[model samples]
Target: MSGPKYLGHLNINVRNVEISHEWYTDLLGLHTYDFIPGRAAFLSANVELSHEIALTQVAEGAPGLQPGQVGLGHFAWRVETLDDLKEFYQKLLDRDIKITPRDHGVSMGLYFQDPDGNGVEVYYERVRADWYTQENIFTNEKRPVGDFPGPWDELAAD
Candidate 1:
């Protein structure tokens, strides 16, 4: 059977609204458009698109995300520029967010946990469509950080 309709916005249950809100804004460059106290918050990109992320506070004493959980492993947000990913990764490091950088065959990505230990990925697609083939499926092979050179330096020089 074919997949259903496209994915809409994501609703994440976070531990703290203000903290998660700030972290997402800084790391992903999302802007807050609406906030409902003790209930939920909605954020979107600076562009004309509608809300892309929604945060709802979980009940008190609820267990947060754990490795090998049953549902919602992680979600990715694509970036147009490698420099944006680099800059945001640095900012996350500065804020003491646990970041794990990886280079998928077709993409460069930075993995970090949110304030509530929910894994989040901000990635840039590096491989052109023409490069992909049936023989080479882009697998998540572990590699050294910084091994995949981002295009930031080249873009900045121009």
Candidate 2:
């Protein structure tokens, strides 16, 4: 099945609304808008689009993201290119964001976290035709990543 024209936004419950608001704004290189002092806030990466992400403050002392727990697996961003992905990788590194890299055959990605330990992935797609499977869709192989620098180059290049 064909995917939609594009993904729009995500609504997430964060441990602290104020903190997550700052985190996303900084990560996306955009400012927070339509924000209430506490409770919920909206973020946009571009002016033309509506809020790309909506953050709601979870109750205080709530347990943070549980990796093995059944819930939202993760969210993602498709950068402009390999170089762009690398730039984000470097930015993340500079800010001490831990990255776990992977090669999905059709795409390369980095998995990391936000302040609340919510999993976030940043990835770049490689050649389409070469990675497409005989099943007439992109291969879903989750394997080690490719060469070139990244947060987990040592393991990914393998």
Candidate 3:
């Protein structure tokens, strides 16, 4: 069986490369692998990889995506455990970024947007048995998230 293994990288357009570069690096903990000032930047969590995300600068004052727009909805970054998710959740709060927390039965997710309004999600998956089963592969049930941090506490009632 020959098929693609995983997503190699992603490229997105931003209003300013320098701004978005700093934003992504600081927010996602990605380091600069390569950069072209005022034009583009390549960032990665793994130094081994050339880049996991590439940011290309667009003209200033360009309009951002509007509600109900038909386009790339969002991209996700997966964290390892509940603790990691909590740490990241704190980071988002420290940065004063708005968040939408969701419990997908098999995982917990924090959704937010970047400087240019690019949707991004950070999630922590539960054990494989919770999500890898045939019948329970994709679940939208609201499950209790014990020990949830901050806004995630609301999910406890579900």
Candidate 4:
């Protein structure tokens, strides 16, 4: 028998759908396909999909996921290029959002939390031809924040 072709979507609980809706749309550039005000909302990065993420509002004071929680750790999105990642990094810096950067040898990513404390990661992976080899395919390393190199310097000088 065949299994599922790909992971379809993720549904997460939030304190308020409207608030998390704004946060997801604004920070991660996800477009909302449907929203039900205070109750629930569905969003997606691809226009073709109905929704890649669905947010269901719980109580306003619902407890958040803790560090050692046995549930969802985080969800990640992959970008197309290093320049795109740098641009996003700048946006986070401009917004004063606390971020943790990670380097996985084949990719670099930023980790940050949403308004409801849901962890999210946005990253750019190196093209397979550029980083993949027969014997090795993975490496995990901590990257210092603000180390993304790009045209930010020129833009800053402008």
Best by TM-score: 4
**Model 2 poorest ten-residue lDDT run:** 149-158
Model 3 steric clash pairs: none
TM-score of each: 0.77, 0.78, 0.85, 0.86
lDDT of 3: 0.83
Relative to the true structure, candidate 2 reaches a TM of 0.78
Task: Note each model's CA RMSD in angstroms.
Answer: 4.6, 4.3, 4.2, 3.3
Model 3, runs deviating above 4 Å: 139-158
Candidate 3, 1-158: lDDT as tens digits? 89999899999999999989999998899989889998999998889999989999999889999989999899998998887888888788878899988866567888999999999999998897766343534642444543333555443332
Which 10-residue window in model 3 sums to the lowest lDDT?
140-149
Ranking by TM-score: 4, 3, 2, 1
Residue-wise C-alpha lDDT for candidate 4, range 121-152, written one tens digit per residue: 99998777765353345432332334445455
* True-vs-predicted CA distance for residue 89, candidate 1, Å: 2.1
lDDT of 1: 0.74
Model 4, stretches more than 4 Å misplaced?
139-158
Tell me the spans in candidate 1 whose CA falls farther than 4 Å from its real position.
1-5, 127-136, 139-158
In candidate 4, how many Å is residue 146 off?
12
Candidate 3, residue 38: Cα displacement in angstroms equals: 0.6
